[model samples]
Target: MGGMNKIDEPTIERARRGDHRAFAAIYHAFAALVFSVALRISRVWHDAEEITQEVFVNLFRKFSQFGFQSSLKTWLYRIAVNTAINARRSHLREDARRLVYEKTAILREAGPDPAARLQAEEEANALLDLLPQEQRVCIVLRTIEGLSYQEIAEVLEININTVRSRLKRGRETLLAWKQGEPK
Candidate 1:
């Protein structure tokens, strides 16, 4: 396959047979690219680091399954994208559950000194949770991650106009929420 010069057949066979050095060589060659993709998609350094590790671990386990029908880079790219997106979705779901718990906890605990900062953060997160996944991701990449419109499009692998439309719809939804209107 194309771009196979970075990894030879011997190394692949060794890695498939559980050679640590062979695996390390593969990791060294692709870790940066994997991490870069993960960071762009997840927008969190910590999550990106975790995703990179998870990808390599997965590669080690599934090394024997490499059929060589495609370049290794392409396969790794697919894995990183899927892993990062799944991790982001999983995190959002966990955040939603945690938000429910925190809301209930706040209601139960009556105190004049409930931190305003924490309340504001929870409100922001709740507002974000109201958005659809696609729009929310675009909004986060644009607003929270400080990515440009073109950058968001590139990272999301979408057309620039699609990125713009998602951001516009997301903003409209947030505005409606602020105005106490039905979304």
Candidate 2:
């Protein structure tokens, strides 16, 4: 459908019928992305790996419950984020948090001024630093990941309006933090 391995609707339907190949197709399609998101949330690579494995294992175990309410990918991402959050909360590994530098994040293309670029990146990172994990994930999914509000709701298993509220709150927190600083 999309690439060579895109799982078509029919295939997904069959996978819902307990087709092994279809299950594998779903897993292969989403594993890397799930891992990446988990890694970002977890910060520690090993925790991310554990969470990814747990999410997939849960997916396969509960595969039968997957109705066509949302795309399979969205469901899996929800499970991923939830599992990672739960794990982080349970462990309270607050010290392991990582800052996301926008420059290192956007190094794909060359920019005009390296110094100004560095400052912007640092400032963006600093702004993000003030938010909690829930707020950060909402912002990251909405802005950095380009997920629509509905899609984010499905992926986070939140009400669509709740997603909007969190995004708003997160944005407000960021804005206040920014405005509180000197220009």
Candidate 3:
């Protein structure tokens, strides 16, 4: 059963041809991780779920081109990141824009009292708002998701040095934001 933990690239290759079960298994294996990527990128559970569904739909649609150039997890995350960004952008539409804004506001206000612990989580999310999407994604992938620089580079399709630059710049930006704030 040890082999169960690993996806068979050959099986994936067959699935690429027309195997529905293989695709279903692949989806089951990666959905949570993809959802986590969506959540981290989006900073909201509902948006993440929506993004996760969209990612899977897109993945299945684009399955024939997966190419096996990267691990399935890496590819899945790349898809998740791309789809989440696109969906987040699309959420600005009349159908999604008002709902997104309203939901974000509700989450921000639905917390309990201004206790220090609660405030800390809220503050961190607030700080992330100050980051550009690329930097935020780099920090989240490196620090939060514990992906290697190479993995992040593959997922983001940027050079390794660019990942380093983004992580550094992201940390500095967060530090500056923190430092510039009232105590």
Candidate 4:
């Protein structure tokens, strides 16, 4: 949200009016943030990349619908979160279908010499995956994205107390997981 504040009303107006430069400027400013959020939620690099592209396409198409009521960052966060969640759900469904047809398909492990950091990150993401989707989203926004509880509430359109509760539960679950306790 730091660099995001630099995008002013005039820039937004220009983008809304279909100015390509303005739109590109906005994309440049926010694409990384959006992609990181998507990646955290989707847990697949390719899916996250696609989600980022889809988000920008949707923003361009729906730019005119954005009222000035909410900050643009909040609006973008809402879009990114919803889009990522939907993509993750669709991916899970597709995987289930594929599994039914490819029962004999062999699974590949990570490369023989994967980086330690990468392995740790994969383990962390796997743990996050164990949480319910709602709780996972709350934890991602709060911890990884450094969003405030109120900001998370605004982005997810939930009560602030619900945000707090979800984060609390999510943390407890992750702690239990790390401690080798049954979920």
Candidate 5:
């Protein structure tokens, strides 16, 4: 809703009232944002695509429940975040199962050390992995997604102070870890 004009009101109303055409238009406008957020959360392209589709399907199913209190963009972001979180949880569970069952079996030959091939960008991203997931998500939303603290609070349904603290802690930890790393 940051830059959205009043022109979107009618489309939002129609979509809320179960108009497929209006909903499709809404989808067109926000699908990329939804997918991008999902991708950033899940860190998996396929999971992001699935989460995006699920978010739209959920929107259509619950559109009537929308009270227009929040912008459609914010609503979509909430859905995307929830979907991505669930998908990530499921993915981790599957990974745990694979690790337990495949511990004794070798599916493929071991590869060389991946760290040896790290590029500058990959090394930068590696710093992100040092933070906990919640802190990482806050940093991603604030810095990478360019959302304000209040905007992140709205989308995340948390207090603004929580967002500020997470960002502060995340930045401090990232810096500390980077400094502790060998050049």
Candidate 6:
């Protein structure tokens, strides 16, 4: 909602009317945000890319059903978060050895610097991965994406207090984990 003025009612109307250019414009505008959220949640770049594509597909398919009670950003956030959560659940059931192998391959492709920025990003993603998915979603939405509690609540379809609760718990968990880490 911050700078996503590209998804206004007129654009949505054009998309709903089967304007491919309008849909492509919406995808171009929001794809990065959606992909970042998915990658944060999933910790897999390819999976995040797929999730972004799926989100746009679902958005197009469900466009007619949108009631417009919330901002388009809110609706898109809902779809992205839900899709990422589902993908994470399925991913967890996959072979752990394969996941490790893929991660190693990714790290190798990241270059030889042990203290590289990619390592820092990996560490940050690992910390987020330590969070339960429910709390992690709230934390990412609030801290990383800069959504307000009310906006998160609306996007998550939960009470504002629920959003606050999740944020508090998520922060506490990250603090505890950080404290336990070696300096």
Best model number under TM-score: 6
Error of 4 at 97 (Å): 10
lDDT string for model 1 (1-183, tens) is 124338777887898889999999999888877886676556456777899999999999998898776556667766777788898778766663332323444455576756764485467667766788688777766675555786566556689999999999999999998899966
Which ten contiguous residues of candidate 3 have the minimum total lDDT? Answer: 94-103
lDDT of each: 0.74, 0.73, 0.75, 0.83, 0.76, 0.83
lDDT tens digits by residue: candidate 2, 88-157: 6765655444443334544555878777876765665566557788777777677756678888877877
User: Which is the winner by lDDT between candidate 1 and candidate 5?
Assistant: 5
The per-residue C-alpha lDDT of model 1 at residue 183 equals 67
Model 5's C-alpha root-mean-square deviation from the true structure amounts to: 7.5
Winner by lDDT between candidate 5 and candidate 4: 4
Point out where model 5 deviates above 4 Å: 1-7, 96-125, 181-183
- Could you give candidate 5's per-residue lDDT for residues 59-149 as a string of tens digits? 9999999997877777888898888888988987777333211211222326564334334325545666577778878887887677888
Ten-residue stretch with the least lDDT total in model 5: 98-107
Alpha-carbon shift of residue 49 in model 3 (angstroms): 1.3
Residue 16 in candidate 1 has what lDDT?
82
For candidate 6, lDDT tens digit of each residue in 94-132?
744334213554566656674575667777777787788
Itemize residue pairs with steric clashes in candidate 2.
none
Q: How many clashes does the backbone of model 6 have?
A: 0
What tens digits encode model 3's per-residue C-alpha lDDT throughout 1-183? 113236778778877886889888888877768876787677766888889888888777888888877887788888888887876676645353233222344346555653554556566667766788899888878876788998899999999999999988888888876789532
The list of candidate 1 runs beyond 4 A from truth reads 1-5, 96-183
| Model 6 alpha-carbon drift over 4 Å, by segment | 97-116, 181-183
TM-score of 1: 0.52
